[model samples]
Target: MNHAQIRAFHAVASEGSFTKAADVLNVTQPTLSGQVAALEEIYGVKLFERRGRGIEITEIGRRLHAVTLRQFAVELEAEQVLLSARGLMSGQLRVAADAPYHVVPLLATFSRLYPGINFSMSFGNSQQVLQGLFERKSDVVVMPNIHEDRRLHAAPLKREPLIVFVDRNHPWAARRSISITELPHHRIILREKGSVTRKIFETALESAGVKLTDILEIGSREAVREAVASGLGIGVVFESEFGNDTRLHGLTVRDVQLEGLEYVACLKDQKNSPVIRAFFDQIQSSTATNLS
Candidate 1:
């Protein structure tokens, strides 16, 4: 009946447990349970089936939860509108990035300009980044090599050449560059599937007819870097991203024409959101000023 009771029920239904739902709502477990109980009693409908420690939402609960999702989303949008009208003095901006390399610097610049705005970041592969945007889990996404998607608007920020890297102890460490055909001779460590960098590099290799014999697939960029630095294998990454790690040496693939174009993107509907707009504006200003 009331927003408090609705919020309690929604949280409980979404989280599937009164304890966890109470934690999410920042209220005591008993208080949260009381609120939900009152709502169900008033409506004369059982929203959830209580097991010993677990809870299951009934069909009616699921329907009500779906409606509450839209209702709360609109409520949040209203709050953001008010915050935007107040010159963006305070608001939360959630961003998802494929890697910190492209997003951290940009967020740092935005924070410097609007210190009051709270920013949070999540990292995943490019596919996950896009999925976050679609699921409304993130306000924006930073990635590279993203193709055109009508549901989103992507702005290219920078292009970085794909390059090879190896540990100092590796025989190829002393070399400034290597040929694409020579890849099979060295152990190749690649990022897992859905990684844009891995896709680009692999596409280039396939086009060049270079089939790597020894391949290791790692899930994270940090892992790939550590593996290569430990002389486990040769790693490929964007030149701009592979910072000056003294333990590893970067080498250009002489005949490969692969590059990653970093981009900042958001759902097309939210492209004009105050937080998203501000971030894009900062990118433009920074690009014009060559701040990086």
Candidate 2:
């Protein structure tokens, strides 16, 4: 019924624990519990069910939480609008990056321009990054390759080529360029499932009728690079990601002959946010300059 109760309910629903929600809201546990209880009484429905040590949101709670999330977003946007009218742009920016290398430069530039704005970044595979955007956990996402999603509006930030890398000791290291079919027999080290790189690689391989052998899945880009450097397998990564690596020499960046991929995306509804718009503009201009 009140902003305080709504906020407490949302926090508890998100964190799944009254104690953790209290910590996040900087309120005592008892205060948070009382507010939630009051809201439950007003609604005449149990919002959450007690689990072992935490709480699970009830079906009604999920619906209410979704509505509350939108309401909170609208409220925050209203505040941001007021702040912008007063020539102030000070707020938290939550971003999820599928590929950290692609986001670093853009974030650095944004930080330099808006020194007062706080940034919270999370790194994950492309699928997870997109999920974060859908869940409203991240305001925007930077992805190496974006798939078709009705809920997202993707902007073409940059189109960069994918390159193949191998250790210096590998036999293929001496080749200038290897055919896609040649890769099926080699040990291929790829990023974990849900990564754009993995998806792109798989699609290309499938198209070429090249089935890779002995695939080793790694979680992070750095881990993939290390695995390739140790002569475990060859890896396919963005060309920009291979800068200044002395140990692992570029065998030959085989031009997969695929179209360059997009690197940025935003939730369709969140595109109206002023902060997100500004950041998108910055990224567009920066990408244009870099590509030219």
Candidate 3:
């Protein structure tokens, strides 16, 4: 098949809609449709089954799409290899992260080291970050919680302790530390269900036999910080991430200790990629010095 026809077919098969595929390819809908039609006519085979506004991939289409996926991946690797051999300083790196606090600093450091490298970052919860890595949408991910996935290579960044913060005007503001059992008696504001911070905090509470009763769920860390500063409820976060917010008071939990581990990760097969390796090396060196 001709390149244009194959591209149109692949786009359509991936997107499931001609209109969306055309958008992805930056081509007019008619032109995309014509290319795909030409391919099918030349081959004397039906690649897709049309339904009202959507299309379903036929058996042959599915087979072709599988081939295209592998083909595109290999093509991308070939491009990277050529770029490396040419000693090119410029390329794009897409990174996904569960939190900006863990990612932005490392990215800033990388940018300074390789000024020509462009970075595009997307933020989500831990689950979404992991999903992006698995789907090959991102070159690397910065995450707090990692599972035992043999397909991934993870490097430790830092371990941060989870602490509590409250409004400056709240009763607990004067206290330097509080026991874990005292948590259930107060209104606690925490990150939403998917948060690794929330997961670690909850696990610690469970281990201490202190159940969380009065709780308010906030979706973002900034929102949680602001709500706590407004005297809504106490907030839980990594001590290093709490920063120096003047309106809030950060308190240590004396009886319970919870630490969240940060990691820089890439697919095991891609660990040796030039760009990924450079970034990973910096993280390893930086964390090692901090630990020492």
Q: List runs of model 3 lying over 4 Å from the truth.
A: 1-81
Instruction: Choose the strongest candidate by TM-score.
Output: 3
* Each model's lDDT: 0.85, 0.79, 0.85
What is the C-alpha lDDT profile of model 2 across 3-26, one tens digit per residue?
Answer: 999999988886668987787778
Q: How many backbone clashes does candidate 2 have?
A: 0
In each prediction, how many residue pairs overlap at the backbone (N, C-alpha, C within less than 3 A)?
0, 0, 0
The list of candidate 1 runs beyond 4 A from truth reads: 1-85, 287-292
Candidate 3 vs. true structure, TM-score: 0.73
Sorting all predicted structures by TM-score, with the top scorer first, yields: 3, 2, 1
Q: Would you list the clashing residue pairs of candidate 2?
A: none
In candidate 1, position 158 carries an lDDT of: 82
- The segments of candidate 2 whose C-alpha lies over 4 angstroms from its true place after superposition are 1-80, 251-255, 287-292
87-154, model 3: which lDDT tens digit per residue?
64987789999878879999998999888888899998888789778666889999886877876999
Residue 148 error, candidate 1, Å: 0.9
